[model samples]
Target chain A: MKVRWRVLGGEWQETDTEAKTVGELMASLGLSAEEYLPSIGGKLVTEDEELKEGTEVTFIPVVSGG
Target chain B: MVSCSVCGKPAIYSAKYEGKAYCGEHFLEWFDRRVRKTIRKYRMFGSKEHIVVAVSGGKDSLAALHYVKKLSKRVPGWTVEALLIDEGIRGYRDVTVKDFKRCAEEWGVPYRIVSFKEEIGATLDDIVKKGAEAGLPYQPCTYCGVFRRYLLNKAAREMGATVLVTGHNLDDEVQTFMMNIMRHDVERLARLGPVTGISGQEGFVRRVKIFYEVPEKEVVVYSVLNGFFPEFVECPYARLGFRWDLRHYINLLEEKYPGTKYMILKSLLDIAEAVRKGKGGTPKRCTVCGEPSTKDVCRACELKALLGIG
Candidate 1:
């Protein structure tokens, strides 16, 4: 499957990976659930949510302050 | 393909708390409308009031400033300006100050900066060093928070602003509520709301959190989509604070059960309302700075005396 991951204020890249779940994909990228909020196709997806081909995922940091 | 919950278009953000997906156009619309709703619901400011937006060069404040600036254009007689406080963190704050000034210039908002060194005769670095040497019981954030609030309010009032708008989003509010609960600080919790500070109080300007209902992730996405996303930098001192631990724990809960942040905030509001009704006391002026205070000496004044700063 091809997953496009965009990190806010950072970079966007496409990768072809065999990961089947959102959690697996995040683990492959060395990302943690505690730090980043992940959404697939504009809807927040859980770690167990199955990833489909050509899904666009965005990662946003969970912490912000003024 | 998922569609926007409001309109039939490619959705760009899924607001889990609201259980709604929004396309770029609709998302911005939804976000702005919700902000307006918060303002109206809280009666934060009048249409003709001057608003001082506290910008930290972070995503949250920048977005708040941008949105308020945009809203000011439509609201007749409204004026918006930006204020930045330089806490004097050597490596961290200097960079964010530059980002803040650049954005303020780009947005054409009149801006002013106040610093700890100029206002208090000591930089935060000096305070931390002296605090460590003096063996102060509190962390650096304790001093920073008290002084920042003091400076922000003073500067806003000096600018003749009736309302001081901050970028505290839902995540920050919830974490603070939880922290207060854990510490059993009822007075501090009572003061938490979308808007705070009593009107007609001397030396007190109303402070409103425009993004109180909005989540942190949504603020980032809004900042990113609107071309306001600056590089993210966490305060070096923040890592050592209890709030940091609370933030991580809250985020974990939010991930497992979406809308947990909002639920916490809702409960806090209810409790805060009850506390406010039960408590009736006027704010006293700080003896040192003449600012509104709950105690004989304000927190800022207390910290300054501890640091031996003028």
Candidate 2:
């Protein structure tokens, strides 16, 4: 299945992945679940959330800098 | 869906550290209770204190301001205001400042802005440029951190704030603790706590971190749920510091092993308390600026001399 993901303020890019859930997707991307809050369709979601084909996920970086 | 620990509603947050999940309503209640517990445990403030929230127009600080403002409405004689330090970063600080103003007005909290250009005679852009031109070893964060701290303290004092509040959460604290340990800077570790700085000291406003025990992830959730999350903006110079890399590694550990961050924080507090117990000497006044300092010239003044700015 293909899922769309992007960091906030960045362009969304689609990736074909075998990952079944948000936690798996984050693991595949080498992103820490603690650092990014995944949102689907403008609502925040937990890692157990299943990913569907063409689901757009915006990963909001929770950590602020400086 | 995970059920809320309290009421079995669909869980909105799962706090792995505590082995509990909270639905939207319960999460807010839990988060607020934690905030209150932290404040009470630390004795952070009296009932009648004036709070100056040092906001950077980011999610963390803005969230801190929002909660504090919400809290002060019920506490008689408590007043809440915001103070922002504009480091004058070309693209970042400008955008965040707009968000700050909008939120302040909407929340009915009075706010003041201090800029590096006005206070230090140069914007952060200029400071970075000059540092590069002079072959200075200092990174952008160093200059920004020193000046921001100097201004926040000075501005908060001028505003008659009895206490200054910051939005620093668990992740920031643990990262700093590890950094200090790696650098062998144990004395700085002594300063980390829920309420920091030398209390009852002249020229120093006590700094309180209400979210000292809250995780950054929870902070983001709190802000979003409360409808006050600021527009996300990354500091342009954030990647230049050791902290950037360190933060990622720490978060990775936290992701793999739940409660890693909390364990680190516990270690930090214990170490800090031990260090505090052994400390007794008073801080000296900066010769040039008269701010509380350990050296004759404070870091801010030292930077000013290096940049030839006021």
Candidate 3:
């Protein structure tokens, strides 16, 4: 399956992976589910949320400093 | 699809810490109730009060403002206002400030914006450049943090606010706790809790963290659900601080060890309570700015002198 991922402020890029869930995709990309919220198809979803082919996941960072 | 733990509707969020899932409606109810519970537990507000919400156009701060505004509508004598400190970070603060204005107006909450350039005689960008040129041992965050806190207290006090509210969640609290412990700054640790500062301090406004017990991820979820999530803009200088590194590492631990953040917060509150029961530190007035401080000169004044700004 292919999943498109991007940080909130960055550009989206595509990656082909066999990751089945949000948690798996996060692990595959070296991202921590604790630090970022994955918005799949414009809605925030849980880690167990299933991914479909070419699902766009925007990782919104939860922790930030000013 | 996961079902809502309560109503059988489709669930939008799974509260891992509580082992429950919530639909949009139940989640808001749970979150708002939890926030109110924290307020009640801390005795955060009076019957008639003016709250100055420290907003930065981020999810946490905006959600703090939104929730406070919603609560105030039920109390006739209570008023909520937004206060923003413009640090003059070109790309970052600029974008967030626009969102701040939009939300404040949309919610019908009056707001005040205080700029570092106007108040401190230099913008944050200017201070950073000058500090670098002068070989000052400070990061951009150091200057930004001191000035922002000083200005928020000063502005809130001037606005006759009974209390100042911030959007600091559990993740922030734990990270600061670990940072303070690492630096052996126990005095600062004593000052950390849902409520901060000595009540009725002459120059300091009482500060409360409404989301102190809430996790950062929940804050994001709340903001998104409430439609208060602003454009996600990362501060340009954010990664330069030790805090940025600490935040990432702590989050990693939280991901691996599910309840690590809450455990850390529990320990922090325990230490803070024990220290508070022992004795409170005497507050000193900054001879330069006359703000409450530990030393005769406050950190803000010290930074101003280092940056060669008035």
Candidate 4:
């Protein structure tokens, strides 16, 4: 299935992959290991969870804390 | 003919450092080394983490951000993120908005912009309005200092930034130091230093001033030689007139005495230590925001209420 992934400040891109898990989608996106699990719409979605066709993810970089 | 005093070579002796003479090569080398040493001595950004730069879209911030990007890439263990706060200065914010947006794109650091109007109830202009209502010609910079800090701190915490770096340099510090001297604000001087961390605040990030020790001229040279400023206009409300006078006064003192910044910092450190030693009470939690504060409300909250915010 084709899933849509959009990056903030960048245009959305679609990818074709056979992988059903969020972890697999992330692997396809070229995310490095150091990147933390991001909270999508306020909940942290882990690698094992399955991603749907139209799910949106927000990657909050872990920097800038007071 | 005697050797020049500045770079110690044969050149026409001129009046910069008391009729000093030096070759062009020595002069450039001396200036370069001074910039490097000051950068290192102040420990501007720690080598281990990605640096989050706070730019106001002004010359000082733009220069600082650009230089840090160049220097960090050359030195390992250095990464950068650029953050800008649009204080909504009439034409100024709009003028620099596009450039600031493009700056991070040019440098390739994931950038975030938080507007003053969006995050807080008022832009800097609004703060001055409320402040002016009290019949005080209080500095816009003072309100800007407070608002900018709160915005940055909240944004930093939200992003989990390790180091919050600013563009404050020697001249600003020297001017502030002179202000402290005029007011005899020994405690304030002490609390102000290269790196500052408010006490008893668990989530408070450490603030570092990389250019804290560098002279104002070096920063100006770094900017002019490089010629890129996202925006260049004094704040519309910089009507205090005193701060500008203070700046000139410090420059005059610096002409007669170099290293005045170091002297002021030295005095500040002494007072900071004294304040740390039994000078402050256990800071109570602010009733409003629950952040650590000795008083019922934090300065941010107080100012927020002044604007009729919750």
Candidate 5:
């Protein structure tokens, strides 16, 4: 399974792993999804969301944005 | 020695009337009373026009509205209008706007909200997303400042406000000055005053600063001592890049040169008097709204166009 991580509105990079959950994937990348809100399939996914093949994860930084 | 939270000047010989400590120039009672006095002293309000204050639901803004409204009853000709600009941050904007509404209702001032969604068709979050999408050279503070200013003026115009008041106190002023100077934009550096109303200017609303003289540390102490505002240090995006750097640098400068912020602003005020006396920044008419603009299309319209709105 290809686990991928990306910054929202940014480039996505592929991870060479069969990570079973978002938690595992984040741990692989040495990050916490709390601070960097990760989303999958247009809905925000928590750390418990089990990863499938080609799971596209996005690390959305805490944004005040304006 | 208690250090001034604003200019970083130490209060070597001072008294604490509670947890609020004050130097001679910054005594909390004197600061509060004088700020309340300057509003009346200058007669900045009118009988017919609404005294609309732009609030960010922050500690400073809440205090500003409280004082302004407190004085409005005493002043007679004045009434308070609380204006909150919703920048369209997801949970953040919702929280602040709700707080503003609740506070206004409690205080009995007419409250109105102008959201970025309706006004600009896009939120600050959208702008940030798009910038990240484009990998663009954009500053978050730039977008925030531009959007906030444009919306505040638009809201003021819509509300038919005579004078628009903001929660900018001494520290905010000094930080702005330091930022302008860092960018070598001396013109804005010279324009820091309580009232930023360009005289003889049509279509431009006057920006009166009631906190022109109040210090930021004093504002904080006053807010805390008075239970006027919620001191939430939990802005998610506050710790982001650049502006944080600028803030830290300003604090460092204030530490190195005590009273640097106030001294710089005091001198800038003198310069503002002269610059304001002379024809100021190029004020042209916006082709879209006919309001005062530096360009044919004002920032609001330009932003709307950029975001495919309005």
Candidate 6:
């Protein structure tokens, strides 16, 4: 499966992966679930959710404002 | 693929609370409309008012500043400006101040920068250092929160701003509401609202939260989509306080049960309304700074006195 992941204001990277769950894909991309929220197909997805092929996920920073 | 609820375009955001997805264009439109709705609902300001937005070089504050700047153009006789407070934290604040300045310049909003050292006779670093040396029992945030409010209000008033705006979103507000409830501080809880600071009070600027109802995640998404995103830098002292724990706890709840934050805020507002009707004592002027206070001196003045600074 291919997944496109990107940070806000950063370049998008398309990668081929064998990850089954969202958590696996995030780990494969070296992202922390605590720090980055993953939205799959425009909806927030939990780590347990099964990742489909060619899904576009945008990882948003979870840092709160003061 | 999910399409936008309004227009059948590829969706970029799913507002879980609203149960709707929006494309980039529709999301921006929805975000702006929600902000405008908050303004109108709270009656934050009107035409011929000078609105001062507090920018901390964070995404939330910058997003609030951007939206207010956009909203000002449509409101006749309304003007928008930015205020940045340099807390004088060596590495952390220096970077954000630069980001704030750049955003203000880019947005063409007039801005003023104030510092803790200049206004309160000590930088936050100096305060933390001295507080440790002096064996103060309170945390650094106690001093920072007090002094920041003092400086923001003073600067906004000096600039003739009719309203002082902050980027406090649903998460901040809900976390604060929960913290207050857990502490059982009715006095503080009574003050929580979309709009605060009593009007016609001398030295007190009416403060409004433009993104009060918007979730933190949506604010980040909005900032990114609109190209107004700032550098994500967490305050070094943020995790040292109770609010940090509350924030994470609230985030957990929000993640598990969507719209939990909004429900908390709604409950708080209802409780606040009930408390307001029963509360009667008016605020007194602080003897030291002449600011409104429930006691003889304001919290900022009391903290300053404890720190042995002006």
Candidate 3 Cα misplacement greater than 4 A, ranges:
B277-279
CAPRI class of candidate 3 = medium
Report iRMS values in order.
4.8, 1.4, 1.8, 25.0, 17.9, 5.2
**Candidate 2 lDDT, A4-62, residue by residue in tens:** 99988899999999999988999899888888988888777778788989989988888
All candidates: CA RMSD in angstroms?
Answer: 3.3, 1.5, 1.7, 20.4, 13.4, 3.6
Clashes of 4: 20
> Chain B TM-score, candidate 2?
0.97
The local lDDT score (0 to 100) that residue B137 gets in candidate 4 is 48
Across B1-310, the per-residue lDDT of candidate 2 in tens digits comes to: 6688899876778899889988879999999999999999999889899999999889989999999999998898899999999999988998999989999999999989999999999999999999898889988988988899889999999999999999999988998899889988877888778888766779899999999999999999998888877778778999999899999898888877999998999888888989878863467889998898767888899989988877
Residues B241-278, candidate 6, lDDT per residue (tens digit)?
89887777776666567777788888999998888777
Q: Could you tell which candidate, 3 or 6, scores higher by TM-score?
A: 3
Put down candidate 4 lDDT per residue, B18-38, tens digits, no spaces.
445434455445545765676
Local error of candidate 1 at residue B170 (angstroms): 0.9
Error of model 5, residue B280, in angstroms = 2.4
Q: List the pairs of residues colliding in candidate 6.
A: none
Q: Count the backbone clashes (under 3 Å) in each candidate.
A: 0, 0, 0, 20, 1, 0
Off by over 4 Å in 4: A1-66, B1-47, B134-137, B229-231, B256-262, B278-285, B292-296
Q: State each candidate's chain A TM-score.
A: 0.84, 0.96, 0.93, 0.63, 0.80, 0.83
DockQ of 2: 0.68
Residues B139-241, model 3: lDDT tens digits: 8988988899999999999999889999999988898899889988888888889998756668889999999999999998898888877887889998988
| Most TM-score-accurate candidate | 2
Candidate 1 displacement at residue A34 in angstroms? 7.3
**TM-score (chain A only) of candidate 4:** 0.63
lDDT of 6 at B150: 82
Error of 1 at B242 (Å): 1.0
Question: What lDDT tens digits, residue by residue, belong to model 5 across residues B94-197?
Answer: 77666677777888988788877677667888877775666656665566677788778878878888888887877677767667767877666555677774
Model 1: colliding residue pairs:
none
- DockQ (C-alpha based) per candidate is 0.30, 0.68, 0.64, 0.01, 0.02, 0.23
